[model samples]
Target: MSKKKKPSVLIYTDGACSGNPGPGGWAALLSWNGKEKEISGGEPDTTNNRMEMRAIIEALKALTRPCRVEIRSDSALIINAFKQNWVGSWIKRGWKKSNKKPVENQDLWKEMLKAMKPHDVTWTKVKGHADDERNNHVDGLAVEASKQYQ
Candidate 1:
């Protein structure tokens, strides 16, 4: 018998920080079928990159089942990590970078990898604070969520 295809999901994510290591927030907009869901959270002390990774991890965790997911974000760090196989290299090197230094946000990277295992994920890079309405909306949500900790 032919296997059934997984549901296709589109997710938009963004992260904001009031002061780099200060209050930070992450937001994600997930769309599937005719329904859409928005999720967001904040941290009292976090970096923008951590928040960015958090957005992706949380979005994937929100999925009830395995899916074909397309994630759009303005974070080149997140996108390039997968596109360039940096995560694989890091893992092979005992979580160390090419410079022989420890990778930053290694914890979240592990979480993200776990969250992604159940799905076929595609990463798309978008221009932040640009003309994309969805990107802008998610950015606003992230910024607002960060303000909650202020």
Candidate 2:
């Protein structure tokens, strides 16, 4: 008898901001092998960037096995950080930004990296509200969550 390989996972995430420094929320949808899981949370006072990072972290944490992950997000901060190799710089330098300040959302970033260590992830940037169904749905969920929690 041999163990069957786990299915690959796809995740879409969106983070909402009521105000730049106001209420914020994050939403994520995880899908694998015909199963879907939606997760979300909000902070009474926060920024969209943090929520965006949190969404990715949460989605990665929810996986049951090491698998391929496709993560979609509309957040430039989160997308750029990965796409631009900024996280690598931060990690290479002990998680400090260019100015030696602790990277914003370091806790979540650390967790995300750890969660991702056992798997492979590919990040895709989706334009918000531009007919990207999964991203839009997650965005709506984040918005609703922010409104409810604020």
Candidate 3:
């Protein structure tokens, strides 16, 4: 008997920041046919949430065509914010937060939403620094991106 394999997907993600508003980075993986690839990037000064959002956005941007993707992040803010449909509501309301203030990362959120429009996306939360393989890969990539970032 032979085991079946899951379909290809852009996968698990994570991002990190040295400080609330400091060096930050994001990471992701592309998996298919028993192969996997990792990618990441960062900015010198940014927020943790921004990196989290950037991780997913950059992963989607890497795809040449719309495809199914499963994104796992350690960011409850990102996960809950997205899963609860808050982002859509925010977009509809001109990117305002519940306090009627402008969203912190409206630019990235808008870009992320647009990038995801053509794909089937599923988001999950994983405890950071846990043993999750893909999650760890992305975390590593994010950290590396931050360190190597210009």
The sequence of per-residue lDDT tens digits that candidate 3 reaches over residues 20-94 is 889998888878668787888899999888998888888888887767778778899888888998897788888
Candidate 3: where is the Cα deviation over 4 Å?
1-10
RMSD of each: 0.6, 2.0, 4.4
State candidate 2's TM-score.
Answer: 0.88
Candidate whose lDDT is highest: 1
In terms of lDDT, the poorest run of 10 residues in model 2 is 3-12
Mark the regions of model 2 whose C-alpha exceeds 4 Å error after superposition. Answer: 1-6, 99-101
Worst 10 contiguous positions by lDDT, candidate 3:
3-12
**Which lDDT tens digits does candidate 2 get at residues 13-96?**
988989988999989999888989999999999888888888888888888778889888888877788889899999999999
Off by over 4 Å in 1: none
Q: Candidate 1 vs candidate 3: which has greater TM-score?
A: 1
**Highest-TM-score candidate:** 1
Q: What are the lDDT scores of the predictions, listed in order?
A: 0.97, 0.87, 0.83
Q: Report how far off residue 87 is in candidate 1 (Å).
A: 0.6
Can you write out model 1's per-residue Cα lDDT over 1-150, one digit (the tens) per residue?
999999999999999999989999999999999899999999999999999999999999999999999999999999999989999999999999999999999999999999999999999999999999999999999999999887
* Order of candidate numbers by TM-score, starting with the best: 1, 2, 3
